[model samples]
Target: MDDKKIEKRIMVPDNLDVQIDDKRITIKGPRGQISKDFSDPRFSKRISIGRSGNEISIVADSNEKKIRSLCGTIAAHARNMIGGATSGYKYKMKVFYTHFPITISVKDKEVQIRNFVGEKGARTARIIGNAEVNVGKDELEIVGVSIEDVGQTAANIEQACKITKRDRRVFQDGVYLTGKYLETGERIKG
Candidate 1:
């Protein structure tokens, strides 16, 4: 069997402070602060943020070659966290009504989906964690620090309108993802 290896890298934002405590990390910026405790033991990540200089470094020590890439992956995730925390992330979706116009609202932190597919009533989208969903002027915006959160929120909203046992070729009427973003509010140029 071949032994795994551990690779390391460092990432820093153009403007932000990154701090690390044990396995936990905290990223601070003008927008807000993002912190969490991660215990995976697969890699070691540390953050240092101050006037002197802000930096996040990752290094992995293992006996297997794969461990190197695994560490790099973990570090990449950490880098993504830094980027997400500093600038934040958002996902945009648009409601498409081919058959019947659907009305969706975000209230009580839960999304109230109504009048989908000309059904009798509507459906509901379950809000997960701190993910924020806002529906304004035909635009659905999903915002959060964690990419996973924003992505999952979009998923929840999309899944809530999913139609099972229906011919997708014929019944193509529902809310669809019209846009996405990387925390800059600028639409994802696709």
Candidate 2:
């Protein structure tokens, strides 16, 4: 019988507060608070999560590759939550067009893209969670406490400007991610 155990621990920063209740984890810091539910019905019986002092632990009874991978994924998620709550995440994007001038605007929870490829109608993308989008003449900035939300928002903008039924090599007009950084101005390598 295989009796090996898999475990991973995440260290919580002093400025951040971590709370674990059942399968839900909540982290609060200077930037903001983020709550995530890690409960999966299929793995609930095989894995357990707990906290001791400033360390969060994820343990699995089975040493199988899949279970071990899941433990590591959970630990990584917790680390991202801690970092996001403390420093926040930022995504920078630039608008590129060869012919028509592209105009972008944020209204409520939607980002409006106008004059794309000279299209009369506008295309819109939905903003996820509490991400804030700043629109400039040729650039956009997305900022949020949750990494998922910020990344998704940037993707939405890029997808909204997707070129269809056009020559791929010639007409290269779209929104592209230029850089990602922490709120404190540290560049994150993609």
Candidate 3:
């Protein structure tokens, strides 16, 4: 029974405020705040998370591979939270249609796609968390402080326009993600 400890540390940016309570971590910045619970009954007894100075540390008591990986995973998640809090995330989507013109609109935390593939009824995608959707002439933009919410919202819009019954390559009328960007207008590789 080797019980060597494994630990990972994530540096917190000066612009962000991090708070650790129990197994939950909350990060606040100029854009918004996000809180995530890292508690898992399976690993609760083996792993511990805490913040010291300006760094977050994830410590694991067991030398098992799974526990070590969990420590790294928590560190990655914390880094993402810090980045999202400081810079935020944006996803750009473009509308494509052969004949029927597609119209997108945001109404009360829901994105409505009208006349997609000449469909009579409008298709709706739910907005997650505090993400904001802006519909233009032929494009849509989704922005949020949390990467998970922004990315998921973009995926929902893309999935809603999936063509199932149509031909393999003919009916290619749908919404697609074009680019991803940070709040500072820096492009992010998709």
Q: Pick by lDDT: which candidate is best?
A: 2
TM-scores, each model vs. reference? 0.80, 0.97, 0.95
Measured with C-alpha atoms, the lDDT of residue 166 in candidate 2 is 79
Q: What TM-score does candidate 2 get on C-alpha atoms?
A: 0.97
All-Cα superposition RMSD per candidate: 3.9, 1.1, 1.3
Per residue, candidate 3 scores C-alpha lDDT tens digits across 22-78 of 789999998889899999999998899999999999999988988888988888888
lDDT of predicted model 1: 0.69
Clash pairs of candidate 3? none
Q: What stretches of model 1 exceed 4 Å from their correct place?
A: 1-7, 41-53, 63-66, 185-190
For candidate 3, give the lDDT of residue 154.
94
Q: List the residue pairs that clash in candidate 2.
A: none
The per-candidate count of clashes, in order, stands at 10, 0, 0
Q: Which predicted model would earn the best TM-score?
A: 2
- Deviation in angstroms for 74 in model 1? 1.8
Residue 186 of model 1: what lDDT?
63
